[model samples]
Target: MINLGEKKLILASQSPRRKELLKGLGFDFEVRSKDTSEDFPINLDPSEVAGFLSAKKAAAFAHEIVPNEIVLTSDTVVILEGKILGKPANEEEAFEMLFALSGKTHLVTTGITFLTLEKELTLSDTAKVFFKELSGQEIEYYISNFKPFDKAGGYGIQEWIGFVGVEKIEGSYFTVMGLPIHLVYDVLKNL
Candidate 1:
């Protein structure tokens, strides 16, 4: 467990995966996020999307932050062939994303930001996830059951597809899941 002396932690995100990952760190925290647009500038490099969004999310708390409280915000994306793949809008889009990812390696990038009344820090982590060739039936089953419309890459790394199709991962698994827990721990420990 990591300790933050007299500091209260606030998570400014709605992602269940992020909440769960943060809980694994054994710290008490409160969730507080405002509705914010996820859109980004057209010129941002694919690699910078996550970090840019994360920091943008953190800005929502700019006026309300109090001393002794830290706000955490994060964003994640799936990049293949230099294109960013965000949450799919529907089953058809999800199927298309999954099919494109089939038998290929993609980068999963997550950006995390820590904001306090006095200071702020933002960082990004990337993981290479390689998938096995996914059959149409398998893709349909996973999408129909999981309905990953809210997940970047239209799939969850902890779900059924990952169980069978994820052949290799090159970085922190937690990053692919949405929050890089190790980095979070390290940041909080030193803060």
Candidate 2:
């Protein structure tokens, strides 16, 4: 367990995955987040957009942060070729995303930011996830059952699809899950 000497840890994210990951670290924190736009500049490199949004989320809590409170924010993005794939809006979009990702390798990037009343630190971790070629029936079944509308790239690494389809991963698995827990632990342990 990591201890933050007399500091109150505040997690400013709505992602249950992130919440669970943080809890696994054995740190006590409160979840506090406001709805914020996921929009990013079209010109941003897929590698950079996640970090941008992570810091943007942190800004929402800046005004209310106390001296001993450390706010954590994170954002995850899926990049295919060079474009960012956001969470799908519906089944059709979800199907398209999975189909495109079928039999291919893509980047899963997660940006994490630690903000205090005094300063801010933002960092990103990227992972390469390789999927087996998904058949139409497979995609349809997964979408109908899993309803990946809340996940980036229209899929979750901890779900059924990932269990059967993910053949390899090149980086931290926690990063693909939308929070890099090892990085989170290292950051807090050093703080």
Candidate 3:
């Protein structure tokens, strides 16, 4: 178990998966979702893109942090064919993203920001995920049934599609779930 010492932990996001993953670390924390527009410049690398977004989210909660509080923010994205696939806007887009990812390996990068009154730190973790060739029917069925509008790359590793389609994964599985628990725990411990 990771102890955060006397720092009051606060998570600044609305992702239930992140919340659950953080809770699995056995640390006490609070969830406060902040509304921040996610817009990044085109020239940034994939990891930089995620880190920038995470820092943006953390900065959005600047007014909420106190002296004894540490706020966490994170962003995850799937990069395939050198393009970043964020959350799909609808079912058709979701199917399209899945189709593009079929029979290919993609990179899943999650950036995390830890902010406190004393210091602010931002870091990123990347995972490689391989998918077997997915049929159009399979993509359609998964998108129609699961409605993965909230997941990057239009899929979740813990979802039905992952069980049926994902072939292999390299690096931390929790990063693909939208939070890198191992990295987060390490950062918090040092803090």
Candidate 4:
């Protein structure tokens, strides 16, 4: 367990998984998310996409942060063959994304940014997720039932697809889900 003394932690995200992960850490915090553009420079490297968006999200709160409050923002990206795979737009896109991910390994990167009135810290972690060869039926069933439009790579590792399709993960499980709890805990505990 960790204590923040007089400081209040604010999560600037709407992700249920992120909210749940932070709450599971036993920290009392408030969720205040404002919609921000996800677009970034097309020239940025795939690996830097999350970090850039995370920092952009944090900067969205620059005018609202108080001295005793810490705002945490995070973004996760799925990269395959050097291309970034974002959340799907619809069932067709979801199916396509999942189909493309089948029988391949992809990198899941989550970038976290902690902002206070005085200082800021931005960091990212990468996890390798190997998916077992998937069938069309598997892809259709998962997409139709789970409707993973909110998750990167059109999948959630904590969901049914993860149990049936994911072969193995090389990094923190929490990272693939959304936030890297270990890194988040370490940073928050030290703060």
TM-score of 1: 0.98
RMSD, candidate 4, Å: 0.7
Q: Model 2, range 1-191, lDDT digits (tens) per residue? A: 66787999999987889999999888999999899899999988889999999999998888899999999999999999988999999999999999999999999999999999889999999999999999999999999999999999999999999998999999999999999998889888888
Segments of candidate 2 deviating more than 4 angstroms: none
Q: In angstroms, how far off is 68's CA in candidate 3?
A: 0.7
- TM-score to true structure, per model: 0.98, 0.98, 0.97, 0.98
User: For each candidate, how many residue pairs have backbone atoms clashing (under 3 Å)?
Assistant: 0, 0, 0, 0
lDDT of 4 by residue, 62-161 (tens): 9989889999999999999999999999999998999999999999999999999989999999999999999999999998898899898899999999
Off by over 4 Å in 1: none
What is the C-alpha lDDT profile of model 1 across 1-191, one tens digit per residue? Answer: 67787999999988989999999899999998899899999899999999999999999999999989999999999999999999999999999999999999999999999999898899999999999999999999999999999999999999999999999999999999999999999999998
What overall lDDT, based on C-alpha atoms, would model 4 receive against the true structure?
0.94
Candidate 2 local Cα displacement, residue 106, angstroms: 0.2
Residue 35 in model 1: lDDT: 91
Return the TM-score for candidate 2, rounded to 2 decimals. Answer: 0.98
Pairs clashing within candidate 3: none
Per-prediction CA RMSD (Å): 0.7, 0.7, 1.0, 0.7
